[model samples]
Target chain A: MNVFKLNSWSPYVAGGMVGILICLSVLITGKYFGASTTFVRSAGLIEKVFAPERVEKMDYFVKKKVRIDWQWMFVVGVFFGSLLSSRISGDYRKTALPPMWETRFGPNRARRWVIAFVGGIIAMFGARMAGG
Target chain B: MNLLFWGLVTGIFFGFLLQKGQVLRYDKQLGALRLSDFTIVKFMLSTVIVAMVGIYFLHDFGLVALKPKTTALGANIIGGLIFGAGWGLLGYCPATAVGALGEGRWDSLFGIIGMLFGAAIYAEVYPALKTNVLAWGNLGKITLPGVLGINHWIVIVVLIIAFCSLFYWFEKKGV
Candidate 1:
């Protein structure tokens, strides 16, 4: 095994573990796990505060929307959990581009930033079109 | 018990696993897209099986209400296709995107932002698309066994066996 490659748990083991966690989610929360909903709810809350009419009028935001309290907290937890894990595992690195990527992509921060933004838009649109 | 709390826990677990699986690496995801690796398929199948079995048993024992809604086939197919495309292009699904962020992959941050933007845009334009896109069809929460006219447990068992078989084959083929 390449210890220097990166830290990764076995896929089967990780899948089974996540599967059990999802089972717990269903049992305790009565909801299937989803990440998109949180983002939508947060956006709704933003709209609700600044542009109530728009949020209310939007078909996607009008139904089954979560309040800010729960949705934002959940997103925050994701960030924190990841940060903690990286810290403990000694795998945390702050470089924007990996070494191999730097060689291939030429360390063009501007290009990376633009790609990231456009990619975000395309991905988001695609996800929504897919019923998220 | 709240959706948010559970979502958080799920997010953490997802991130941990992604890191552990080395899936945060862009190359691994690209490999899966190229069909050279079965890691993603195996992971997804196992997840569905676990969820299906767990939900079935929970509902069966009256521990939870089985609100088995009809599966919206059109939506599912279209949604799945788009989702798969996004998975291929961005190398992260909604859940795994969060996991990627957790593992400190900067690209995942873009993916997450894109997901949020896409969702928000959908919300903004939902009214215009409601009649056509949203109401195009309705299969209504249909499950595998429900459509097949077989016992639910049998369906679950068969699916598990099939998945295991596929896993076995993949392992043997070393793909």
Candidate 2:
């Protein structure tokens, strides 16, 4: 049997599969799915490791400081899942940057770096305001 | 063993699908924005329908606990708009960005990092905004079936028809 490559599935097909996966998640675990929480938790862990006082005082970080394993496992699963998908599809490429990005953003890499940092800040701010 | 675990698993699966759909590609996402490719719309529509149906059933059966009622209508709409803009700019949402990064696309790393930063900022500033910015409106859990006074099943059927018609129209338009 031929397995479908990462790019082989049509959008609808892949979406439906994802939808089913969502259903499975609900059935098996009974929770809504999200990604930002993992990152927030990781940030908490970083703070805990280097600056315990900061982690303890910050309301946002404090809540996530406990039970670090659960969030870490989930984050690890996501990272590995993506890696496995890429490997199986024969589409894995290891580089700090893509060629098109380098060409478009320029050789300094400063533009991309600055945009990413600002963008990350804005995204996290929005999530917290929304109570996520 | 509980809902949180399932949530994580579901997230990982969504990451996988994002990779499979090539949605992590900047070109594909940009193409969708241009209306040259209907992939994003199609995919989102299908997923929303599935989620809606699932939620409806779960509520109907008392299989899951619903969130306590909150009436932050202004926040929901504003947050949704901001999120949509971010999605367009980044070419990937929080979930897919992880998958993209997993595929070794450095740009996705930026996207994920951006999301984390955004969430953190929100947390720090939420108290100040909660009173003013979040108090613009208070429409609590408005649903089509509730507003229309129709049976849940009927509402679901109507939505299915409407979505299918939209899909057909888009297909006809050669998108």
Candidate 3:
């Protein structure tokens, strides 16, 4: 079978791999794999650039620390890894919007941006509030 | 350096799996939210079940330590609702957003930017929110096993059964 193609794999296979990764992650780092925390941490780092004093005073920042930790690197790895996977699979494309989105939202780049941004904001807010 | 290396390695594998599983696809995510496609749901459920079983077994064998986070009821309910809403709208969670970006879906950038903004907003309001809403119903570091005083394996079994039943229904419904 060709290892490089623009097609999806079985969900069961992917999930199995993820399961192994989770177990390994815990064994290696005693933490779960999550992306929201990294985003929140990045926000803290950015806010620190503007208001170092205030950001430091914030309890969340103080507790989590606005530094590039393992999770930060993990997220970076994810981005690059995905890029690598797409390249290897020959599925890499520079599309602004996917077809599904175009059909539902009428092919407007600005609309996609707005919806994604607002949705991201809402999702992150909930994630942080819930300690996700 | 060792820890960082391990994190990167594990994350790469996880990211690969996510991309392979089609979790980064906007359609799959939106479909899962709409109850139209069960691909993402099945992937996530199976992941949870497998991880849970392996985790507790490892813990039992004294190979790993279990550090479950506190179950903050208020935070969970509020955050879950908002997260679900956002997932429906953007068809991207924090994990899938970056994965999609890596796949060269430039629209994913907006969601990432929004997530950063959202986190900043949460930080800005933390001083007030922490004392009131965020701290509500704080069930500290409680797990199902701990709460029921049962073996972790039992909880894992139950979760597997429940998830499998759901998966069967999803298959039957063809959604």
Leading candidate by DockQ? 3
In terms of docking quality, model 2 is acceptable
Per-residue lDDT value at B67 in model 2: 48
Off by over 4 Å in 1: A1-6, A48-50, A69-72, A98-106, B1-7, B67-70
Ranking by TM-score: 3, 1, 2
Q: State the local distance difference test value for candidate 2.
A: 0.66
Better of 1 and 2 by lDDT: 1
Q: What does the lDDT read for residue A92 in candidate 2?
A: 75
Please list the residue runs of candidate 3 whose C-alpha ends up more than 4 Å from where it truly belongs after superposition: A3-6
Candidate 3: which pairs clash? none
- Model 3 Cα lDDT, one tens digit per residue, B1-175: 8878877877787777788787888988888777788899889888988888888889988999887888878888988898888777777888889889998888889999999999988887888887888788998999888899998788888888998899889878877
Model 2 chain A weakest lDDT span, ten residues long? A64-73
lDDT of 1 at B137: 70
Give RMSD (Å) of candidate 3 vs. truth. 1.6
> Model 2: how far is A121 from its true place, Å?
2.3
Best candidate, TM-score: 3
Score candidate 3 by lDDT.
0.84
Number of the top lDDT candidate:
3
Q: For residues B1-175, could you state the per-residue lDDT of candidate 1 as single tens digits?
A: 4665666666666566656655565556666777887787777787777877887888888775565644555555666676666666566666556656666677767767776677788776767766666566777777668789889999888889999999999899998
Superposed on all Cα atoms, the candidates' RMSDs to the truth, in angstroms, are 3.5, 3.3, 1.6
